[model samples]
Target: MSSAWGNQVERWRAGINAWVTSETDTTATIRVEAVWQSVAWGYNVSNGVSAFCDCDGSDTPYVGTGGVYASKGETRTISMYTRDFTVPKTGNDRDVRCGAGVRLAGGYHDGTSRAYCSVRISHRTWYQPRRPASFAAKRSSDTSQSLTWAGDYTGLDGGYPWSGVYVDRGRDGATPSNLATLGWAATNYSDNSTEAGHRYDYRLYSYGPGGTSQATDTLTLYTTPIACALLEAYKPTATTVGLRATGAPAYVDSWEFQASTDGGATWADAAFDEDWVCADPPKGTVRFRVRALKSSGGSSPVTLHGAWAESNDVATLCAPLAPNVSAPGVVATGTAVTVTWQDNHPDGTAQSAAQVEVTAANGTVTTADVKGAATSWTRAASQQASAGTIRFRVRTKGDHADWGEWSSYAVVRVAVAPRAAITSPAASQVLDALPLAVAWEVTDATGVSQQSLSIADASGAVVWSATPGKGVRSLSVGTEAGFTNKSSYTLTYSMRAGSGLTLTKTVAFSTDWAQPVTPTVTPTVGDGYTLEILIEAAQTEPAAVSFDVVRVNPDGSKTTLVSGLKGGQTAYDSLPPLNVAYSYEIHAYAASGAVLNYVMPYLLDSDGHEVLSFGSAAQEHLALRYDAQGSESGKASGETFHFALGTGQDPLPAFYADGDIDVTGSHSYVIADADEYRAARRKLRAHADGWFRDAWGNVAVVAYSYQISYDAKQYMQWQLQLDVTETMWEEPNRG
Candidate 1:
């Protein structure tokens, strides 16, 4: 039992014997007998059956019901019927081989794993006798004809001797009636019964043991004189032509000879005799043809009648019409231009094509082709000779001869839109005058129907606006109250033409009003009770001031004697008059950093008085820029001062450093309003924000650190630097 064969499956082939019982075009019914010889013990039952190409149209599956048993040495048969089988029949389509198959229809559980045997009905088939090839009839004379053919006659049905060869005759156009029967061995026949002007058709067939073959190839013939036509056509001149042919002109009772101009589009006819000639032809290439007419009331000419002969084609030429042309008044770049024309040459000729002549403003003349005889043409603006004043002219040429005269130039200017530029007040300019004058220029425009310039203030109010007249090339605007010091303004300029042309531009500019200048300081050190320092105001009134008079003891620690005082000539009478190496600093600030800060004053009194010469600790500097836009005074347990900036700054790509190329920046200035703050912001915005932008603008966070103290002396003092870190950059009024 351990041997491999013990577990192996012995599959058996279920035997099927099938044959077709009845068949329709699409379906067939088959009778089947399924018998199983028990190759394995007790494996002999099949219930139902199905088969292919038999009666049933589908393939057979296992049958589980009907039982067939063939006990050792005895045979049992199970008969089953299947219907709806596809017969696949058409013409000679035959189920001649082992075509029908059967199988158990369903749910059969016999030990047999395969079909044991399959039997298909078989039979021998035979073919018909071979028919002769090329069996044809030809005229032997004006009144007689002969028929001939060739093929193997003794090779059909395993060499079945022929019984006889049958021949038939009929008027060429009528049904053939049976004629005499010839000896089985003959393949040719002669007849003296054909007419001179008649046609004839012939066919040959053969038969043997097998059914007759589909009729043999057929042959057709004509015994008429005109069927042997020989026609020819010739042109003697551009307007004259002649035709000639030979056959039995005597039998060609009537003939048709046609002439074509324009490659057969139309035809002109004449009697097809020897003297045929066509007079004065119209416009086109000439081609000719002739056909032999059939005898009036008799029969068809022939099976394959004579056709038109080989001939030459002639083109009738004439003068072409000079094109009458016109063009549009306006043209644009990359747009199509339409030019129309009419061709009218008295000699009857077509307009071959229109020649376009173009002239540019620079006097460059160029030409183009508008091909075809159409009444109109379209050319893209891109295909125009030039983008300038492109003038056009037209002419035409035909197959006949000459190119017609070019028409007068139809002028059209290539349209281009106006280009705008700010000739004055360059971008981001800081003007000092209250009424900023903005000037702009427009070139390449035909005219300006409406041109206006407007400037908007911090609150977005249009403080100034004006419209320029037509034909205006440039405009300058200086409006009252149009500009505000320490504030930024947006200027927009736009223009419109009657031809629907448009151009627009916008730019930013601001003005600086309070420019701090250095005050004239005259310091006279005096021994009196008050230090007389004569301080004259700078170009503008100095905003605030502070000074320091220090005494350095032997160590580096210094002592303050007279400090934190207001600007003017501060006569500090509270001086300790420290005689120990004393030094001092005088400082001042402009109201805001939008403009320059005034210089510090020197101490002076009575007349040129000095104390140990003079030692200065530091120079004058301006206060940092700060704005009170969203700032308010509030009360907490005591009091609180809260301020905000921007709505907060929008993110920027990068921050700009002090002197970058196209990025212009002014480092020395006071910052007050949004205008001044924005100017300074632009200087560093490109560089600072990129590091990490917080709610407060990086520029504001760094610039507004120079805080002011109200103490008299410190009020005038300016803190030049404030240490900053990433965390300190928060919204200005963040709780």
Candidate 2:
């Protein structure tokens, strides 16, 4: 859309200026200004003009749809609209041209048919500041550094305003880490976080609204280290020396010292102790120097040794005599090691003072001074945490300024920690009875002096304690001890050595006194012709018991009819043989398979028929056959013998004889019929050497015989003989 011309075909001149104002990935904005005069080609005037751009090096106008226009013969500028066009994103620099031409109403007019013009486009660039030059760094103090650089806004891009300068700092040629943006006028900065004697690298960058300039060359610098002032060394004795210094700079952590025995020709590291005796300096003149340092680095040594060289020769006071030293051979971590020594002054002079040096396992040496009258010194246990051999040596001074030579070192071992463990009554074990048996063992280098064992209930009260003594590692407690059933306990055993080192161990256990009780059994006949025995009140101490009902068979054998019955079980039915008497016994047990109770010999007759009989209690009765005769008798017998003696006066030398007595019994019965006779015969043969109780409640075994006179006889005579051993109703084979 452009302005229209009045009745004339507007002709454009080639005097146009075009430049790229802004650019993007695919297109650029070009502003155009032109000076033109309208010339009429014919009386047919064009209505308006349109602007266009050619980007492909071809002079042809690519877009000519709309543009701004100027009125005829008037110096006036009007807005113009251009038709849309596309540019290929081929390169960063593009040759773009913008201009206007006549537009016809029917179609686009060729450039040759009318006058058209365009100008080569130029891109615009903004201004940026230049890099700062002459960069430098300097140390201000031990902990701070100052940076200075000469900089200006010269060589700025199109005179654009700059923001500030950026200083980047790093260490040991590393990439820049710290960045500081300062005002344009600021040419220096003070870094307060610098470490003493540490190296730092710095560079400068200048930036503006346009962009940042290239970085300057890096400058490396190191912070200053503190220097020690007034270093001095003195000899306290012929065998020892001392060094002292003061005046350390701020931020200095500690000082390091070096020694030179040959006039500073060669130096060796020396510990920075106030008194150099522990360093073991040589007897001759010694030179010393000192320096100050932080954790980062150390400063140069301050060599002021001219005032510290010792003038007295080391051999003037006579070389030291060996002292007699004695110390413990072994010790525990928290036990002290006592060392004693005798002053061996050759001249018999009274001793004034003494010094003892102790060397730890890690090669650290320490010293202590004592009066001459003191013969022994104790090394504190707190300083013996490390476990290894430690060494001790002593030197004495007898009214002299020089200390004698140290004695041979006495070696003592700091033993590994003593350990003791409970080996019996394992953890979480359950005990059935009292008087717990406790056992333990210990491994230690130092022999035990005293040992104590104590048992405590779950409430932490000591219920029982063993007799306190040494050399016994185990003890037993019985029911007489103060212990409660159905309770948990902890056993603690402690062993102490003569050196006052103690070791302790503990184990936990519980006591369970719950046991089975003899159940009251009630027997009755059931539907299957069996005995139904009910456990009327089979109770247990803690309610976890099992019951077993076993039948003792006639032929010295046992049969378990029922077993593993818990507390909730009540009754068990047992099938038995017919026509023979039987007895039953009940046993109760705990969950741990321990038999708790056993009650025996509950007798009953089978189905109201019997071939034998046993004694009964006051209200109890046994079934008996009709018209039986029985007899009982006793026999006593003995043997006597004599042997001649060699002595004439002795008539009878020896007589070996003993009297014996046994009770015998017999019974006779008549079997009514053949069937009864066969049954009785079978019963007698089955129980012929088996155990049973006689009518008088004595345990006996019987042999029987029966005689039938003829096959048609209706009755048979049965005869039985019993050999009774004891009056007690018990089976010898019963377990």
Candidate that would win on lDDT: 2
Error of 1 at 375 (Å): 18
Which stretches of candidate 1 lie above 4 Å from their native place?
A: 1-146, 149-163, 167-186, 189-203, 206-305, 309-318, 321-735
Instruction: Note each model's CA RMSD in angstroms.
Output: 28.8, 30.7
Q: Model 1, 409-474: lDDT tens per residue?
A: 777665666778876677898866434556777765566778888788778899887776755545
Candidate 2 lDDT over 1-735, as tens digits, reads 112222233343323334545555445555443323334322332444444333334364523444333444444433333333343433223354444433344423223112233333332343567788777676566467677877766634334446789988886557986478898788888878776544577788888865787888877655544465555555554445566556544444455666676767777876646553424664344676666554432122222111122222222124348789998777777777899988776434567888889898988999999985687899888877767889999998874567889899999878756778898789998888545678888777667788888888988988888756667777777643445556788988887775456778899998776555566667776432345677643554544366777777656567676676655455443334444455676666555443444555545444333234221211111222434456678766555546555567556535443656665665544455555556545554544333333333233443434343333443354333333332323332212
- Candidate 2, TM-score vs. the true structure? 0.26
RMSD versus native structure for model 1? 28.8
Clash counts for the predictions, in order: 47, 9
The deviation in Å at residue 435 for candidate 2 is: 28
